[model samples]
Target: MDRRGHGVARHRDLSRTHYRNGVALSHETGSHETGSHETGSHDTSPQALTSVLAASAAGARAFARTTSEERSGMLHAIAAALDAHAEELVPLARAETHLPEPRLQGELKRTSFQARLIGDRLRQGLLADVRIDHADPGWPMGPRPDIRRTAVPLGPVLVFAAGNFPFAFSVAGGDSVSALAAGCPVVVKAHPGHPRLSRRTAEVVAAALREAGAPEGVFALIEGVASGVAAVQDPRVRAVAFTGSLRGGRHLFDLACARDEPIPFYGELGSTNPVVITPSAWRSRAEEVARGLAASFTLGSGQFCTKPGIVLVPDASALIAALPPVHSGPMLTPGLTDGFRKSLDELSGTPGVEVALVGEPLEEGVPAPVVLRTTAATVLAAPRVLELECFGPSTLLVEYAREDEVYEVVGALRGQLTATVQAGPDDDELALALVPLLAEHAGRVLWNDWPTGVTVSDAQQHGGPYPASTAPATTSVGTAAVARFLRPVAFQNLPDAALPAELRDGASGPRLVDGHLKTPS
Candidate 1:
């Protein structure tokens, strides 16, 4: 115990009362340096939780009522503030996550870029997804009533910040930004792995939104597992956005579904992003593919959810030989480190799987990369062990004799965030056949690029089926993610005065008028 008091770290949270109470308790107990992990328990009273939810609901009301221009202004302000605070933030992120400065800086940049991107989308009012149908006096089904529809906010949203992406998936991450842009008040459940950074980031975001004239509670930050569970359970929370593991996200999904008034839980879960290499492709650019695989898998100590976990290769011999030494930096947390070790053991213990290249040993908290070899037959027989996401810098290489075997392996896959197929120019027919199969199993299918780098753009799809994400039809990244927090509302034969602005004729967003595409005038 140091003399500075463990209360200092707890004070970083947005809850001032709790901070003071924690400090007093620490002093009373004669504790010194207990750390935030010990004293950071933000078990707020049920009344306080309800109050937070109430404020969020009020904020949602205001947010939904605000014009698209207003929301965009706030989003742009948030982007600018993130950039202003980058110097202060990246270091804290690096200290907490053990990620290098350059990577964290890029991530912070991406985080801000994502926010601004949403703002730009909002300016166009594309997410409104408006439609209008003028009443026809001589319609086939008699006289038809004027029908207009546009999406509206789903009210308060609870976002579960992810640990691996300290900046991009943390407090100012995609989920929260999308929810906010969709006009839903965000209550981010700070990831404990980077609580200090989460709190700081939250402060930055809150200030930005507030300065941009966002209503109180438009953005709120809360900590602790209990708080997160309670936020999801709260009736005011209309929908949720989550990004993490299958177990963690599924648990929250279950809670949301079990509620009396069930809400949509958009959870981006685990993925064993598989990359299949054709025999021809391997022969043509084997070294290039090998190096890219190594870089993608080991990027960020393989902490990325999209880190390729399984590589179905025609031949593992060359790729195995090309694999770099198993050296890697520390994982995001000690718990993840242990989980990765257990997964490594499970794969190593499996009957059909063979250890091709074992990485060099490292100190605790840092995992050595591992590569396992198997066949398409082995994978089909024991898909559970082989297909399951290991969540670290290790991958399984499955050898296939025929292209049909590749199809079989792809068939065995559950939903995935991404599936990559490297086909030589001559293997076009095979790729054409396989792309469709891969599309059925994954949200995003790449021809030659790795899935590790998810671009924040209009076209990006960062969600997939089942274990990859609970809501396959929805994305948790990119401009499309705003749809998760918005539900469609139709006004039939409504008076001119009652029509929403976006649904009114000549609105500034893409629309479908009488079942025909109409650009905003």
Candidate 2:
């Protein structure tokens, strides 16, 4: 891929294939080439790849130059277009993801809602201008200049679509919405596992852009891992947003940082989203918490990144008495299901852990949620047991003998997207103390709610530090996500004609007037 501000300029061979139980369904022949400057040896052809990348870059530039009002209109139009295409997109996503129709439909709405939220925020201009002041009449200085800050586009962004949430995190998902809202162009690398669905969604977004008179290059989609690598490493690509495995995200992060001029890579890596049940809450609502936990662990076959992989309960007898038998549906991929079974088998054999509930794996594509119970001491001693993420319908329940031990284990947790507390009215102090601790360890903290149902609201925080996400201060959900795609610039008393149209003070364009940034009235 060339780094000439056009999208990726080189394309390699690319195709979509299915995998079951870790084996490819079909085989095609192609020579694998590796280098910064080799092209045209792949089956998909380099020219085609280059065109796609160029088009994507063009779209991003177009998106960046558009007025905030225009972008808001486009967002609404995109949402409407997505709703119209639901009939076509839903079934394809279901077939590719192996998720039920209802779930896919909900995800589709979530994707649309995210676009709409971005649109609403654009109309409101939430990130336009924030102010800070330090003025003292007694100071020797006659006057203090107002300290002001505002967001600006970061440039072209490369978004790595996730295998799960094909719609909600795909071509028109949160990453795309947030990036576009922040005035950055978006180039999405379609997940190989769901290429057809991704392609169709990309078509919907493209159509919406054209209908809204938006730039053609504001959004583009490409297939294959090599294409993604090329896009991220290219100089034109200023930032990246990804939702996937730690290994995959870390690899991209390393590549981005390795550049002589490194750029930011904001990735939401894997998380063992943990839930803590205080003694008071558990005693009062053990059965309710147990049932809720079961539902979360099994929801969408536990494919959701927010799925709770670990549960902390202080009392084993209470937890055991309240818990139900392990129940689950089919996982997204057969390979993942098989891997979960293998991991479970391995962990079950570990010296200190006990199998609280075990269910046989279903044929190939299906998975049964399994619940394993162990003590905090054992888990702390066998730290390797905590390191692995069982990416399927399974959860580990760790019982703590004392509240202090719960705090210790919680402290030991690595970064996470969310950490939930099931607290009662009497547990306010514990909740307050835990909130800050959880904030340190997680991107979002919840009380009396499940982490799976993330809302695309203004206050939402969907990212965390380190392993949970590469950038802790940023979010992958809600309007603030757009900030990830933006960088700040100060004009320093430039003339109106010299300023970009978006920043010019005129009948047309965005401007800061009397300390308030707004479109001309």
Candidate 3:
């Protein structure tokens, strides 16, 4: 947003004061730019976290005052700046996260592309959702007054960066992009696994925002688990976005709900992302199905939040025989490796499940890709062990003898980010019945495809119910993501001059009018 127009200068001046205070405190405490230390710990007292969050709140007010055009320009500028500096960011991400250079390069581009897409939507005025009701003199239930409804920014957001996909889900990732698109300032709790990379990425992002004329304190970076907890508890932090394990996401969700005023916490928690294959699908393309499942589960060492953890098949023998070889690789962090190993042990130790295809775990920390098998009855008897998300390259194959058994197994599953149905062209009737069932359990239901890669677009949904995500109504990806950071305000009996510009009558801009989407008001 431009800092020189309207009363933007005055607002920026106030935000500058707040920003200067945070900077002074950071320097006084020998802190990294945003209170992050080299060890990814809280290098100073609680004062640093408190000051940075408070400053972010102050800056959010300035950001919320910006129009769609200003923020759109700023967002595009940030994307350009990121692409210009990818040489520094991508290699740093690769070094810290152990991700391949090509993957990191693609992710860096995706991250910026998503930002640009959100910016485009903002410029097109899709975020406002402005609705205007004309004043009526003789109404059925008394006189109908002028009512103008528009969405407003939900104040400052605390974004908890994820360890996986450092470029796509870390410092300047989806959470930060959507929050900024909604005019909410962000204080990112950098993922501890990639501390140096997170800090450097924050620097590039901060510099870009500043150059794009964003108000000071509009973005910040912080470290330490305590600081993250405190961030959620802080009164100024109105909302939070996170991507991590169920344990971590649930902890943050609980903290948000326990706050004095409480707050909305949108977390993309782990998912088992179950896939079911029809007998025909297996008969027609058993090898293809096996290869797809293998690649999906083993992608990025199976660190994806939406990794397909379970596969339901009419006969497990076909898939087991067709299954291709998969190799395990190093996990993101040591703690995660330990968790993956423990989860693997728990699943493999289960009474019914048998190790179908165990990949090579050559080192103490690294575990190979593993595929376990169990019958539908056994899964029904022990759902928790079968349902839990194993963080590494592993999956469970549940064999069902009948269609009823397939439904039973899928019915026992919890909410998920995605669910795939490997069906045939002749299975329309069955697909119709089963698709709705999967839709009820997942945010996105797929057909004839894998869910390893997520496309950042208008219709994408990267969220689901509890265990999969904290907020089912919200998505952490795509254009709809901006909606999480926005709350609707209805101004009653307001004159054209009195209403917000977007809500005024005859205002020729893109927005909803009288509940219908129309261009030029």
| Candidate 3 or 2, higher lDDT | 3
User: CA lDDT of 358 in candidate 3?
Assistant: 75
List ranges where model 1 is wrong by over 4 Å: 1-45, 324-326, 361-365
Candidate 1 contains a number of clashing pairs equal to 0
Q: What do the candidate models score in CA lDDT, each in turn? A: 0.79, 0.72, 0.78
- Give the winner by lDDT: 1
> Taking the tens digit of each residue's C-alpha lDDT, what string does model 2 give over 456-504?
8889998988888899889998888888877776554455576655455
Q: What is the C-alpha RMSD of each candidate to the true structure, in Å?
A: 5.0, 6.9, 7.1
Decoy 1 TM-score against native: 0.91
The lDDT, on a scale of 0 to 1, for candidate 2 is 0.72
Cα lDDT of model 1 by residue, 191-230, tens digit: 7677678777888888888789988778777665556788
Question: What is the TM-score ranking, best to worst?
Answer: 1, 3, 2
Better of 1 and 2 by lDDT: 1
For model 1, what is the alpha-carbon lDDT of residue 109? 89
Task: Indicate the worst ten consecutive residues by lDDT in candidate 3.
Answer: 1-10
Error of 2 at 386 (Å): 2.9
Q: Score residue 396 of candidate 3 by CA lDDT.
A: 90
